[model samples]
Target: MSRFGPVKIVYSDRFLLHDTGGGDHPETAARLEVIWRSLKKGPLAGNIEILEPRQVDRGLLLSVHTEDYIFRFEEACLSGMEMLGHPDNRICYESYNVALLSAGASQTGIDFLEKGQAPSRVFCCIRPPGHHSEAALALGFCFLNNVAIAAKYWQQQYGRQRVFILDFDAHHGNGIQEIFDEDPDVFYVSIHEHPTFSFPGTGYEEDRGSGAGDGYTMNIALPPGSSDAEVLKAMEDKVAGAIEEFQPDCIIAAAGFDAHEYDDMSGLAYSTRLYGHIGRHLSAWADIYCDGRLVSILEGGYSLDALGPSVEIYLGGLCLEA
Candidate 1:
């Protein structure tokens, strides 16, 4: 069966698009603006549902972040000072709330699929990516683990024995991997730059999950100069196999476009064309294993030139409905 089917693209008009804004910032409103324009011109725009990002209550955030960490993050946000990494990721208090709402969008999207209000393929276009953020700490450009929280949320509500998470960020999703490492219920797979040369450095093949969770976590650490062909090979050989075995109730993707060579921040050489391939592969896998259920959350991507087109290509492969 072809995984290609009706797809829902989720987004909000609120400041969710500007969680951490700055002049000439790599991740900025302009990125979403281009994506919006592109989608509007595409046939899929009619089927798209533009929903306002809802605030994820403290309880929901506490599902992945510690209470103390949450309090501090809230405090830092309220203080209107820079939080998380350098000023690049600094955010005002209101921006933090917006980030929370962006995360909340993921939860809402998952719920929509579970209820059959939409198709299995869902995309959340909100920003201030979360794969870099850990459970109790914020790093990179992320403040909260959006995809991780969504996976846990699904597990609790559906009581699913196993859930699969695929993170394709150019940089490793160290935070999510660490958070779910010991839990066998979540299978975490990532294909990223080797830890030796990348930030947050932790996706080594040897860093498999511990205890009963061993082998549930798979990492494909490619060297900095890896090309599109190598990346695609890793996905087909490694990621596809893992998903077949895990047989998850749902699939969540930490989708990042920074791996594109156009992105100055990453050294890996992938063209936007390759991302379409990734999207197509994910669509096929979702069709076979997860009842076509898939949720894709933005994680990272610095170059707008590449970022904008990459999203368009991915959506095309997703087969949005009329």
Candidate 2:
């Protein structure tokens, strides 16, 4: 049994219904399937408890996304538009609802934590990955910003004002950063492939927060071909200090597995073992800084083969005893 008790997995079949017109699309239902299979058979198999997610209250969604954007997204999907603002954001009719549930997975996980329902650690396995989504626009196969909405909900519902978001996705979460950029209450830290060579073209190391939020946002830009050691180094050297100073009320991990060496989403080369290390670090930070309050929301990880094992190892690391 894991020292952390059963880690709750917030998910539902409805997540798979957000069909992205298949041909050559990296994000698909198969992604979650492989992950579920792997976890069922992997090291932490007996330590997980699965839970279905509740749809996000539209009011909660409006907390992060504009009403205009929400209306536009729903209209586009119902009107038979194949994509949203950008072609990369492929969508079908059911996508709008699925996206709301995806965002809600985080809220559900937080509810479990705050209410002392299950374990301190929870993972939201639903997706149309949210990091790339903006408040008013969709990009990089994302619609609703899951982690961001969770942070907002946590603040409003539980009064946990200081939220620390650690994003280790290969691509920058421009949406999350932009939403909380000027807000001192939520600190956004991202370690991603250098924007010069990656998508969305943001997350430069120099772009700290603005005004009252200055020095809150930290972007660690990794060069192409970067590997596990580099990621760990950034966590220990940079992220650790930031978390120490911020002393957030909760830590939200924008957990993305695409940085694995085999995943072709980005040029960075990270091993599957690296995910375990990342999980370990996050777990330790949670215990130290936030009363073991750590919630991980799925982001990007395309390679079907690597995605499964990567997630397995990550959860395994989180379940490990101190």
Candidate 3:
């Protein structure tokens, strides 16, 4: 049904076990449930292949997070603590294991790509989203830094050294930026609502990478009312050039739909249709720069109504003929 081969969706039912107390928390198991139901019934249904995620190795987690912090997180969850370092990062007893599996989704995806698997485009529909998580702290409802760990695994395991991570979440991924800010090998790029108006508040146009990695970090901070035109303009005008210059060995997309106009998580006014364009642009970049080697990990997107459709549209664009 799709021009491209079936897109691999790396996921597992265990991700639902990471409970968030279920009251008014936007990031809940239902988030993944909505996405799964939508994908199964959407136009891309026939083009999707579901795969279970494997548990991530502790050494792989240590690649980005500190050993003490890792121990703290596990102890907190296992000891029946309601939350981690912050109240926003609500966790249940099973959250620690589920977070590991969430991080593992990306590694599983990378493995599929390196093995010359059927689908070149892989999307890890995981939750307990990881972009906002820092090495020593768990902020913004995230546990393990999923995308960051995946980038490290790709480099260490497969020797794909020059990795480019493009995060399009409503809130800046401070954790991701911090992890690779001083590393020249991994380039971290983010396009998010300006930190001045959003949470975790780190990304700024001038916050380029430090020493040895200067200019590797590119941040495009959009105003509160920014729309699809502005996002596309930024992509075409800035992101395109950066990707061309980097010529990365692989691209990891921190895909987030919270910027959608209907989603209350952010002030950005992006529409459901905008996600398709985002996917298309990323797909084209993958084709040109990395031999279609792209792994997209789910990030933010809280609107129950809009999130599902936005994800479906994004996958539709990724599967489109380049």
Models 1 onward score TM values of 0.92, 0.98, 0.98
Could you tell me the lDDT of residue 109 within candidate 1?
75
lDDT of 2 by residue, 1-322 (tens): 7656888899999999999998998999999999999988877777788878988888989999999999999999999999997778899999999998999898888888888844567999988999988889899999999999999989999899999999999999999988988899999999999999998899999999898888889999999999999999999999999999999999999999988899999999999999999999998888888888889999999999899999998888887777
Per-residue alpha-carbon lDDT of candidate 3 for residues 1-322, written as tens digits (9 for 90 to 100): 6645788999999999999998999999999999988998988777788878998888999989999998999999999999997789999999999999999998888998889645467999998999988889899999899999999999999999999999998999999998888899989999999999998788999999999999999999999999999999999999999989999999999999999999999999999999999999999999899888899999999999999999999988887878
Off by over 4 Å in 2: none
Question: Which regions of candidate 3 deviate over 4 angstroms?
Answer: 117-119
For all candidates, what are the clash counts?
Answer: 1, 0, 0
Which lDDT value does model 1 have at 209? 94
lDDT for position 203 in model 3: 96
**Candidate 1: where is the Cα deviation over 4 Å?**
1-6, 16-21, 85-88, 117-120, 320-322
- What value does the lDDT take at residue 165 in candidate 2? 96
lDDT of 1 by residue, 114-218 (tens): 887445567888777888778777888788888887787777766655788888889999888888888888999998989999888788999899988888889
